[model samples]
Target: MNLQYKTIVVTGGGSGMGRELVIALLKKGAKVAAIDINKDSLEETVRIAGDYGINASTFVLDITDKSAVEETVKEMLVRLKSIDGLINNAGIIQPFAAVNDLDDKTTERVMNVNFWGTYYLTKTILPHLLTRPEAHIVNVSSMGGFIPFPTQTIYGASKAAVKILTEGLYAELKNTAVNVTVVHPGAIMTNITQNSGLGGPKVDNNDKNNMALSPSKAAQIIIRAMEKNKFRATVGKDAWFLDKLYRLAPKFATNFIGKMMKKSLAQH
Candidate 1:
């Protein structure tokens, strides 16, 4: 579907790829309702939009709250007039630890923010999207969602749930006006570690050799996938490569990634 003049609602619009998605949508002449948990970060996103800021609206919302999501969707529709797209981009990672070593609170927080949050927003806004002539829903699932990452087991599970949820939505909405696409992004340069309330990862995220994709580039790939109505899209070369490898040899790919990650962690 053409994004021009369309109204899209993006969660996690406060920063990272979410902010870039909002800006990119504005550049494409689409109106954006940028939702984030942080008011200051949302303001920064609008400020960066500069001239295109006029087409963007910011809503401070914690998507984990079902009631809050319901009310926020109503307000967005009232303000934006109609919703043409929804991007479930907000997500959080779990602390770097094995599932056995992790606490219940941390596990629940990751699940709530990464899975249930997406579910609530999609459930509330899908009805409105179905009413439109053409609509789209894009859910961000990580490469970790498809393959296990040693220390990020629970985080991977949450994203894996998102992957299936998005795919299920795609199957159910095949004949409908709404288009669904699930995204698997590899390592990207973002503040997700800090945002997840962790000091940092054991591996060096700042290293130039990490080959992490920029948020803007990731956003562009996502928008293109939506325009083409793709079923799934991988944001970076790493993600794309792994997707193919995993399909060709699931166990080998999993063991390969597990060993690589373990070595990387050990080095740090």
Candidate 2:
């Protein structure tokens, strides 16, 4: 869990939080294998990690392709020598629309990347992780995973599945050497919408000041969580507040969130 001298695999490491995590892990002296579909962004990540010397490498692969994932992880292990951790940060958002208005293909893609993608990698790497003395697994769920959000229902559902899956893994690994941590991040400034192939809204001028967290900060928090072997961590104020609110008053929390998202929902 110290991360130092350990080897970790991070999905979606081309940019955003995933890239930040690669940088952070390298700083901690961990060997990293950064995976993403974008070779250019992955190259950029490795460039930034140059100061860390040969402790980092990049892999270009689609997580949703189970066969590709299996093959890639096998090759990744050869490059990294050994794997001590797996962070599933690769995911996509659904088009902004209600479930009734959403297309089947989009729905499937969302679930495939967000949920099954995580599953595929986890399944492939778990046995190797078990062989290690200690290892960590970090899964990025979202505030929307536990809190309902208009126009993001399918995206939320996919993340929700991840939330439960991580929790279940934690339970199963209670007495094992591997540790599991689920993360719920809120309003981190990232190009997720653009990467997901959905044009995002122009940033509200107010949003520049009001956003809850940054990818670097989130990466720091996640690394801390891994070091501490925490069961769960919420990355931003909004995520923490919503998590508490939903647990205390699900109906009221849903209504409140719906009200806040009314404008965006209308556009959808």
Candidate 3:
């Protein structure tokens, strides 16, 4: 679907890739409703929008609230006129620890923000999207969703749910005008750990291997994928490489990642 003159709603637009996506969409001449739990961050996003600020609107609300999501969508439709696209970009990572070592509250919080939040927004806005001539839905899953990681089991599980959910939607919407794309982003430069109140080394896009893709780059790829109505999109070199590797050798892929992570953690 053409993004030009269309209206898109982006969750977690306060910062990171979500913020970058909002800006990128504006550049494509699309109106955006930026939703986030942080009012200040949303304000910053709108402020940086510059001349496109007029076309960009911000909503400060917790996506984990089902009632709030429904009401927000209602208000967003009134403000944006229509919802042509929905991007489930807001997510959080669990603390770096084994699953059994993690607390129930932390796990639930991770699941609520990453999985249920996406579900609620999609459920609320999907009916409206189907009513349109053409629409797109983009859900941001993580590499951890496909490959096992030592410390982020809960995070991986939540994202894996998103992956399956997106795929199921794609399968069901095959004959519809609405397109669904699931994105598996490798390590992109974002404050996900900080935002989640967890501590971890963030990926650097400048790495020689180019393992980490910038948020802007990821957003660009996502926009392109949506236009082409692709079923799945992978964002970074690491993501693409690992995805193929996992498909070929799931056991080896998991073990390799585990060893590398162990070494990295030891060094830290």
Candidate 4:
């Protein structure tokens, strides 16, 4: 699962952890096809990837756009000549509003990008990836995926679905050349929360997890997981411990998370 000299396709690679991954992969001499809706951010990613002679390039396409996803990946395969791995990082987090408050557009937008987008790209690339002797699919699920947070129930549900989807892929691909890995990221400093409207009173933020690792650090963890072909990797101590607690007592864990969310949502 070495990333060096391999071709990797990363969704949402224009910013945050996805962008960090593109930088790291390029450093390892991998030819990366970075995808994002923001062409400007994607260009910024390439500028930082100067180590690879700027070999990394961006594809401006919305992951939730099915036709665009298919066409984009096809073009990537044509240009790179191979698909070694895919990191599904493109996602949207709407306002931290209750389900009743959440509008149809927001709900559908989140589901379409976070869940369906992952599915569309995975399905389109699985066959091509399977053709390679050793390929990987890294699905970026979240700590939220493991433990439900108030106002984020639907978002969590979408991520949780991604977790199961990854597991299913692993189950069916057993003994096959391809590897499926699920990543649960801890609280990290990224534009995702702020840009996607996850902050403010809409969602809780009282207990700011400052032990929060940066996207670059998280990217390193993910790269390590790929090196070991880890079936699952939890990004920080917080996310790991919380995941265990979740398995032990989902009922209690749910209540605890609710409190945390409430705290974060404290008067700002």
Q: Which numbered prediction scores highest in TM-score against the true structure?
A: 1
Better of 2 and 4 by TM-score: 2
lDDT of 1 by residue, 1-268 (tens): 8999999999999989899999999999999999999999999999999999999999999999999999999898788799999999999998778899999999999999999999999999999999999999999999999988888999999999999999999999999999999999998888898877887744454687868898899999999999999999998999999989999999999999989988987896
Q: Quickly count the clashes in candidate 2.
A: 0
Q: Tell me the TM-score of model 4.
A: 0.94
The parts of candidate 3 lying over 4 Å away from their true place are 199-211
Each prediction's TM-score versus the true structure: 0.96, 0.95, 0.96, 0.94
What's the CA RMSD for each of the models?
Answer: 1.8, 1.9, 1.7, 2.9
lDDT scores of the candidates, listed in order: 0.94, 0.91, 0.92, 0.86
Q: Which residue pairs in candidate 1 collide?
A: none
Residue pairs in collision within model 4? 204-264, 204-265, 205-264, 205-265, 206-264
Summarize candidate 4's per-residue lDDT along 1-268 as a digit string, tens digits: 8888888889888888899999988887888899988899888888877767367867999888889989998898788788899989877776777999988988988899899999999999999998998999999999988898789888888899999999999999988999999999988767786657556422232346456777889999998898789999999888998999999999999899898889888843
Model 4's lDDT to the true fold? 0.86
**True-structure RMSD for candidate 1:** 1.8
List the candidates ranked by lDDT, beginning with the highest.
Answer: 1, 3, 2, 4
* TM-score of candidate 2 versus the correct structure, residues matched by position: 0.95
lDDT of 2 by residue, 75-128 (tens): 987777789999999988987788999989999999999999999999999999
